[model samples]
Target: MGIGNWELGIGNWELGIGNFFLVFLVFLVFLVFPIPPFPHTPYRGSS
Candidate 1:
């Protein structure tokens, strides 16, 4: 039972890391090429 739980934890950790990298990659892509519809300075109301 303990070994099974350990394996499950490792699997979940790996999955989490994979998701983190995927999100990071997507973020980089967006930064490199932002969409036209969305305003660049959404945070600043002055735009």
Candidate 2:
């Protein structure tokens, strides 16, 4: 089935914000408080 016209009217920013909150909720559920990981981490590989 195709998407409904009402849903399509919400547009990209609305979708993006919705997704952002959804992700935050999931993170809070799993981790309690979301502390983002450090950007720089050395890659570990077996020689």
Candidate 3:
């Protein structure tokens, strides 16, 4: 059943204890130090 698989995916993603911390850690790292500044600041005096 298509609907059943969809539910399973959601359940696993939310309930499973594996990789949860890894995902959180990765997000924290990104939040702490972003690769590229969001919205991209324009160069000073360029315009």
Candidate 4:
């Protein structure tokens, strides 16, 4: 039982890390190549 729980915990941790890296990569892509129309309006409004 204890070993099973530990294995499950490790699996969850790996999944969480994978998801976090995926999101980070997407964010970097958007930052590097932002959609012109999408960001223009918001930037103008904020500034």
Candidate 5:
């Protein structure tokens, strides 16, 4: 029982850290390659 509880605590800690790293990576990518504000159309001036 004691060993099982100790392992559960360790697993939870690792899971939390993994999720944090994933979120940080996504944020960095968005900051580096942001979407363009203007629309990319071939006929912007043509009507």
Candidate 6:
């Protein structure tokens, strides 16, 4: 491996896997927030 393991494992590595988790969390939030075609549009129920 180069300096550390070339692949990521669940153990404590020199390059923190927390960074990976932080990015993944941000990505998940991004996916969840922008799904609606019109996010600001209010609900018009049962017309």
Better of 3 and 5 by TM-score: 5
Candidate 6 lDDT for residue 20: 62
- State the local distance difference test value for candidate 3: 0.51
**Candidate 1: tens digits of C-alpha lDDT, residues 1-47:** 33344555567988656666665675576678776776664333443
TM-score to native of every candidate shown: 0.50, 0.42, 0.40, 0.48, 0.45, 0.39
List, residue by residue over 1-47, the lDDT tens digit for candidate 4: 33344555567988656666665775577677786767654334665
Off by over 4 Å in 3: 1-15, 37-47
Error of 6 at 2 (Å): 20
lDDT of 1 at 7: 57
Ranking of all candidate structures by their lDDT, best first: 4, 1, 5, 3, 6, 2
lDDT of each: 0.59, 0.47, 0.51, 0.60, 0.54, 0.48
TM-score, structure 4 vs. true: 0.48
The CA root-mean-square deviation of candidate 4, after full C-alpha superposition on the true structure, stands at: 11.1
Tell me the alpha-carbon RMSD of every candidate: 10.8, 11.4, 10.9, 11.1, 15.4, 12.2
**lDDT over C-alpha atoms for residue 33 of model 4:** 79
Backbone clash tally for model 5? Answer: 0
* Steric overlap count per candidate: 0, 0, 0, 0, 0, 0
Q: Which candidate, 1 or 4, would have the higher TM-score against the true structure? A: 1
